[model samples]
Target: MPSEPQPAPYLPDPRIETIAEWIGDPVAPAAFPRHQLRWHNRRWAAAVGLDGFDETRWVQHFGQFAPLPGNLPQPLALRYHGHQFRTYNPDLGDGRGFLFAQMRDAGGRLLDLGTKGSGQTPWSRDGDGRLTLKGAVREILATEMLEALGVDTSKTFSVVETGEELWRGDEPSPTRSAVLVRLSHGHIRIGSFQRLYALEEKAHLEALVAYCLETYPGSPPPPGAPGREEPAVILLHQVVERLADLAASWMVAGFVHGVLNTDNMNISGESFDYGPWRWLPRWDPRFTAAYFDHSGLYAFGRQPEALLWNCAQLAQALSMLVETAPLVAALDRFGPLYQQAMGRRFTARLGVESRGPEQDAALIQAAERAMVETGLAPEQFFFLHRAARNAGEDDFGTLLRLHAPTVAADDAFWRQDAPPGVLIDEVERIWAAIDQHDDWSELHAKVEAIRDLGRHLG
Candidate 1:
């Protein structure tokens, strides 16, 4: 009798390989992957088939620049050109990062593992390819808080303290450096298509469109778009829905992703590359997140506009391959999608099932006005109103009474002395403790508290 054969060991199934040629440029990471391990997302690792990976295995794949099994043979530095602050910048790309690998998540969705501060590439024109430790810390915090707020955002997969000191004008000089790995939905940015259009590679552009539609599948096209089946028009419609959700989600989360460049906008609608991001201290529509955003282009309330503009650029790129009418029809759906998504998200964040879009809109408007008049931080606003907590207060009484009664705030989280806040001052204090004392206890404590908040929000 013959014994039954056993199946081979589990390995990640990837899709990036199929379109690697037309999408990315093969490149090796600069220098050795010799960074000291600092933080690792063990939970995500298990979902991606690297659960048992030790320090060596982890650093080899993430820090030491070694390729992973069933993944790309070498790292790929993706090419993209974006309209930075309404100005066309052909020189922009992955200047300090590259696509490390791609894998499927537990839910069978494709995910990308990308690197930041691994090394420089051809796009590293005049910059030192490095990431400040503060930047890595900030990204981890941003993602954690955003996820807690139910925003579609990237997870900081790993943080390795690269043994290097980098100088920059933004932060303190001689600052520590780190290499970060991010696990995300996908790395295909809207700018990726812009580059193809700029090069006049219609064939590559079409191929890229097909690859995107097949890879990052989104909602079906709207009813009015006659060419819903057309690859280019369908993709345009899908990206519109996604970016609309992203913009609405951010508005509900009180987040401002300072840089809304076309390159920063992902086709999958997941938020990543957190630079100069901020949560609103109060409900100020004119609040700007970036220090140099003199024009308030990507201000807190204007996020939807910025995202809509980026999607418009994507539509413009797709125009090179498809007609204007269907694409334009798809583009027209952004405003309505944003409005409805915002209503839904706000109601959910308030811990109430949305009764109707109009009611939800009214509640959101009332809440916003109350917060602005009372000078309440967004976190405090949401926390205090968790199922309409403190509903009897002068600040929120009438506003909350205008709606159907919400679930009572019976959870222990509502009884907490104070809710967690990661505003700029709070973030600065966390960083100050690290910089001045070299102590990370506060950072670890904050992350734990953030997870606790997520649990409470559940």
Candidate 2:
């Protein structure tokens, strides 16, 4: 955990100030304040102008829920309704976490500092709202891997191990507890609009749509499309494109975002709130990350389907206030958009550029067939033919040679005996060291290695 020297002071500028009614009143953080700030993401902190703060200040705000100067005076538990496993559930919101503060990044995009296990909120059904230290560690690993693979993802800004013990039905009981702060483009989900629709709050619903478009602005509407005539339709088109791009990114990265619930789908299309996430071991489509996923609904290959279904739910919400024709038009673009995004991202990851959708699609099919034939995980096939590093006379190698190199093959991480990967077994081994002996040497080393992979991919 290297520190940022001579960082700037923290300041808050609330761009989403108009929609305060959507947030629940702030409650006090749980009294489990041992204040052991374990991991701080200096990369994100610097971008958010938080690099100047010391560790103590970090713990006070992130761990203890203290308000930052000029920031939100109180934390806000956001309100939303979501569908879980194809079942619409109107009783879900921020259960264990809340939006602590809102600020802007170096790119001037609005960012929300939301928590995972700060404490219970209005939606705390029947469980204690505390995060296990292992959970925080897993998310750190997830975001690191996703970011390295160029997947749009939320950055784990800070993690603090609070002095508490939690019992859960999932992991071993009496595990240590921690708090995680995530920096995202926006916390508003498709579910947020659903909640407003459920309450029959048309004005609030339209307000949310307006807020989202203003905060997370997207590209101009497609040339003279119907969406150009309506702001809500325009927003829907942007979301559909983003979600399509997000789904393709997951496929190219070999990531299974175990749960693809409506609540987990950020309107900004950034991936966050990782639970039971796993990297693909092989190019198998039926690989499911969550153990309880008996139906394989959110499997590795079905990720695009799940995302498209969630997008339909968003379209459904927007339909309440506007006509369905333009929204459906936006939804229709998802298929072709996904294909193009997948081809572009897949080729970029393999260090090439797409010729056109047809040629690119053929190349993608050839690459997948090659991976499937040998059961080569992305970690193997990508680096095996990375920018002319290990080209061969095979079809896949010949396909690679046709495309000119886009990146210099100077990274030792890719040339090493084993390319960087985040399989479940590896994650468990890293966790076992900490769970048994509180030794984070392996975890720290993994973080550094993942950073190197990010640099290599860049």
Candidate 3:
């Protein structure tokens, strides 16, 4: 673990008068971990004007604020049900999480600001609504790493240790409890819409659709026949496109959301709920993050399909709002949109200029086959390929030889044009540029350059 930093001073949002004003009630304090008190996220706090809210006094009086006045949407405790790995569960909503409030950001973007592990709420079921320190740490790491990898993701707002302990059957002793605040576009899930549709709540479904369009009008409407009057159909189409783009982005970054349940699928299409997630070190399409995913439904390569299925559920929910023919037409666009995004990403990763479908497919298949046969880590291969291209054919030959020992008969083919002595010199120069300092900004720039070449080729 990295050395923990001390808590920074609070910087309140200019839009918010106080914490109480933001939440409608005195913000409730829930104690869990002492070590978890370290919230040294000054940059993020400053970005959202939360630097003024980082004070120790505010920490002590977290649950004591009066409601803040604003155009912030009222965050009702929404109701919804979901299928956990294909098994239907009737009771679920804000389980161990709650939408604290919704507010527009500095960019005039509507975002739902919520807290996980705030406290036990109506949907607590048999367990506490508190999060473990381990969970918080993992989320922090995920947010930072994923953002660097260029994925659209939720950002962590704040983390606080509540100085309490809770036990679960998975662990021998009780773990420390903590609260985490996350900033997202909207917390409404595909399941929220699905549940209403399932229960034949047409009025509520229409209201939800209307709310989404009003909140996120910039999003594209359904495939054909657009207008505000067709809010339900338009909203459904918007969700499908978002989900397609989101899934493609995940695939491009070699990310596995692990769980793609309807409840985990955000209508905004932004990646949310970073639980049981993993990044691929190698490009195995079948790789999965969740150990219990026996069916391989949400495997690395199957994310797009899983998203389509989830969209289908959303479409079913919207049936009450639109006729079947238009709904099917809207659903049809998912495949093409997903493929387009995937094609762009695959081309970007390969350092090859993107041509059309044939060229993209050939390059993608070649890379996939090479990775599987050579047992080379995807990142390692990508780095080496970029280095080879930058250093010329001779240096590339040397890289192939260096990595050759890791493969089998392929070594003979790769070593045919050995670049002799100069390869190491070129590699060292590039490596120095990449690893000269511990600062990640310099490192990320180098990686982005390599990605840029691929995009240019595409």
Please give the clash total of every predicted structure, in order: 1, 0, 31
Q: For model 3, how does the per-residue alpha-carbon lDDT over 1-458 read when each residue is reduced to its tens digit?
A: 01111233332232322222312232343443453343445555544445565466445423322233343333334467776776766677776766655554555556666677776656668877777655665576566545544566787666676677778665334765667777677777788887787788787777777767776665565344444246676777788788887888787666788998888888888887977777675778898888889889889999888889888888888888887766777788899888777766665554444566655555556566666766766555654454134223443333333323221322232233321111123323433442343233433344344334323222
Model 1, runs deviating above 4 Å: 1-10, 32-34, 393-396, 402-406
Best by lDDT: 2
Order the numbered candidates by lDDT, best leading. Answer: 2, 1, 3
Better-scoring candidate (lDDT), 2 or 3? 2
Per-candidate TM equals 0.95, 0.95, 0.75
Q: Quote model 1's TM-score.
A: 0.95
In candidate 2, stretches whose alpha carbon ends up further than 4 angstroms from where it belongs are 1-9, 406-411
**CA lDDT, every model vs. true structure:** 0.83, 0.84, 0.61
Model 2 lDDT tens row, 1-458: 11221243355777655788654556667777587988998878877788877988888888888887778888888888999999999999888988888876655667789898888877889868889999999999999888877888988889899889899989998999999999888899988988888888888888888888999899966886675768789888899999999999999999999999999999899988899999888898999999999999999999999999999999888887888888888888899999999989988888776778887787788788888988888877887767756766777667767764656576666667767788989999999998899889998899888877777777
Most TM-score-accurate candidate: 2
